[model samples]
Target: MGYTYPVRHQTGTLTTEQLHLLLKNPRLIARQVASLTNEKFLADYLLSGRYDAAGGGVYYETETGDLYTGTDPEAIEPAGDYPLIQLDEGVPSAARTVKFGQGSVITDEKISREGNQYVQKALMRVGNQMVRYVDTVAWGVIASRVSSTSAATSDGVGAWTTAGNVLGHLMTVREARAELATGLDLDTVVLPSAKWAKLVGMLVDDGALPREQGNIALSGTAPVSAFGMTWLTSPHITGTDPWLFDTAQLGGMADEKLLSEEFAAAGQTGVEASTTRISDNDSYLVRGRRVTVPIVTEPQAGVKLTGTGL
Candidate 1:
């Protein structure tokens, strides 16, 4: 699950728990088990409309309002490096429920009466990543010397009027969180300041940051001082990681390599059919007991920091 290097100079610095966390990456795999344990429990077992449904059954994002048309409102923008978002104030609590029998066999006449309470109550305790998902950000800046417009004149550095002039920027925490999901899709991103306390509050209010494992860090502009919480740096799964091996996180997903026609008998429906394919439903599965997988940690748990002058 990991590769470790022994630093001769640093001997037994980390505590027992910290050392374990540093060494192991917790892995989760969800199989296609039609039971209470499978991730389907999250999507299927819950009362319909309870857990957050995968948007479009493909990409995951809460900003259904930002749907694209000919223009594709969420078009990519160019930046010097990775663009950043200012943490917004707060977000409203939006609950998504999973009604038991949307497409399933459970009919209104059958368990609707008794199961209704069970599903709602179950949904309350176990929520989906989408429920806690955050994806919203807006950009703004204050001009030095109080310039009405943003412009760069022919000078060494874009300078304002004098020493008294100053400029600052701010982004809503919600917006900052959303940018992490949509823009810089990361597994676990580190922040400059100590923002865990703030992030923990947001999670307490908004829900977990669309992830069971992995970390998003936020300290201060410097290493010593802290900011609040890097809760906003976390990112969502965009297009699937094509090369990742199939596992439990994928709902009882069968290994794609084994499913291919080459792996299968010679005769296949088509060329792609000849190749291996992952099931859409089981991809990114939840961890469970009845269905077990090798405990794997998030891919980018100790993600290296990118961008200059963080």
Candidate 2:
């Protein structure tokens, strides 16, 4: 005779049946937390260009002293030798591209007890951290390359906080930048959040037009276009100084990989993600990574205004 084991039926203990029912009907509470917005990232607006390779280089042409001199054709006799105009290649430069990332781990036991909530939250947090890191790096690159500096009060104009010719001061800087041979139109201005607040407040209090005051009032901390330039504010810009530059010519970012989650079907180029299982720990490791570098190709294209405020 063959040995046989008894088969279990659905008629289990009352407590076990109730537990199964509860598990099948879970109460809906709320949706996952919203992700952060990218509005505060200056890199998105300042840096330009993209590269697919791991590491690359940039070149800036050296400005000649006679760049502004007229080179119009002059009348010459037949067969007379014409003046020779010389041209040269740009100066080559390179910036280091390094990987940056953040990671989080989810244990199997947690998933078995709860669900995939932990994993989803972990990924969101990791992505946010990557964005912050990139912005910090970009700011550092900009601060380092901008060697030319000036004081906002240099022309006897009081700081922006006081009653002075704020618009005139900005125009003066813009004009100075235009005077450079390699300069582009200074269309962008970056200020710390506090300084920006002070500027708007002063303008509004100083009898600004009703329409302008209303616009400023409604645009709480968002970038506003005024004084013929786009004004941007960021908490990451710790100093009281401001930066004026042409975004197109200031610099660029070498983005080798884009930020993406593991198992995501669509993404290309700065940060990426990977998942791995740790057998010993009985957990899954999720990691986010990015490969990029911020480079200032034309240092002269940007000007840093120091002592802009009291």
Candidate 3:
């Protein structure tokens, strides 16, 4: 015999079966919101990859000796023995994955009055808030690791507001890149939204025409490339200065489980969701969560600009 769902006679009063069915569309909407919000997060760009493990520490290599020393075998004499070099095995470092989540309650009264629109809005808000919370956590880890302690003070270029020497700043970034180990370059620069606007305005005033200028003018927040470095802006990074780093070598994200098995099965990897019906409250509780941690493997791979005067 087929299972029978409870019938609803009163208008706007959803049955148990109808409530679960209504959750489907709202859940999809929530996931969509999360996908859009994820694009604006700097953590996804700064952190290169994901480390999957239930529990334990992660290890990463540290640069010690010159990696570009001798490439040609002909350089070594046939009789001479090859020089033995010791590699620095990375130390074990671990960060416990913390759960970030947000809950939204869909009461029958509200659903009865507001219908599916209310449910969609509530669940979408939950998704955005949960993802934003996780993003803040990831950025917190990155900020703590890539601090301004040893940052380079902007020389020649004064505050960006006064049409500061943009080329001069690029030169400084080039010099910083030259100082890094072989095969590593500071190809990414992150700026605050306000500072990025100043940068765009400065460029426009200077009559400097970049390929991305059109898009920048249209959106006022698009990432642009200059001097072989991708310049990005994020609301999460609030400061007058900028951060330059090698995205490939800096760090990564480690997650015990990005999503529950059910969510993974549904192809939603970063955020997980759960639903529960509250008997006493006559409502359904929907929650979204993320379990992850950002790990800065190479602190030296990036630097925060200290006295940019922006």
Top-scoring candidate (lDDT): 3
- Judged by whole-model lDDT over C-alpha atoms, candidate 2 comes out at 0.59
Ranking by TM-score: 3, 2, 1
TM-score of each: 0.16, 0.70, 0.76
- Give the alpha-carbon lDDT of every model: 0.21, 0.59, 0.61
Best by TM-score: 3
Q: Flag regions of model 2 displaced more than 4 Å.
A: 1-40, 55-88, 108-120, 162-164, 207-214, 258-269, 277-282
Q: Candidate 1 residues 1-310, lDDT tens each?
A: 1111111111123343332232122120011111112221211111111121232111111222211122323445675454444443222322222211111122223223444343222322222222212110100000111111112122122222221110111112223324444332222222322233343344334433334233222221211111222222212222111011111121111111223222221111000111111244321112111111111111211122211111
Model 2 residue 301 CA deviation (Å) reads: 1.5
Model 1 misplaced regions, further than 4 Å: 1-106, 109-114, 121-310
lDDT of 3 by residue, 1-310 (tens): 1111111111234455565575654455344444434444456567776676476445444444334543444457768888665455565666677766777888878777777567666755775565467667777777787653333343556544433355566557657556655456767777787888777777777766465554456555446665566777767665567777877777776656544433431122355666666889888777776666778876666777766656
lDDT per residue as tens, model 2, 11-49? 212243333232222120001111221222457567654
TM-score of candidate 3 against the unseen true structure: 0.76
Q: What value does the lDDT take at residue 187 in candidate 3? A: 74
**Which candidate model has the greater TM-score, 1 or 2?**
2
Clashing pairs in 3: none
* Model 2 residue 269 lDDT score: 31
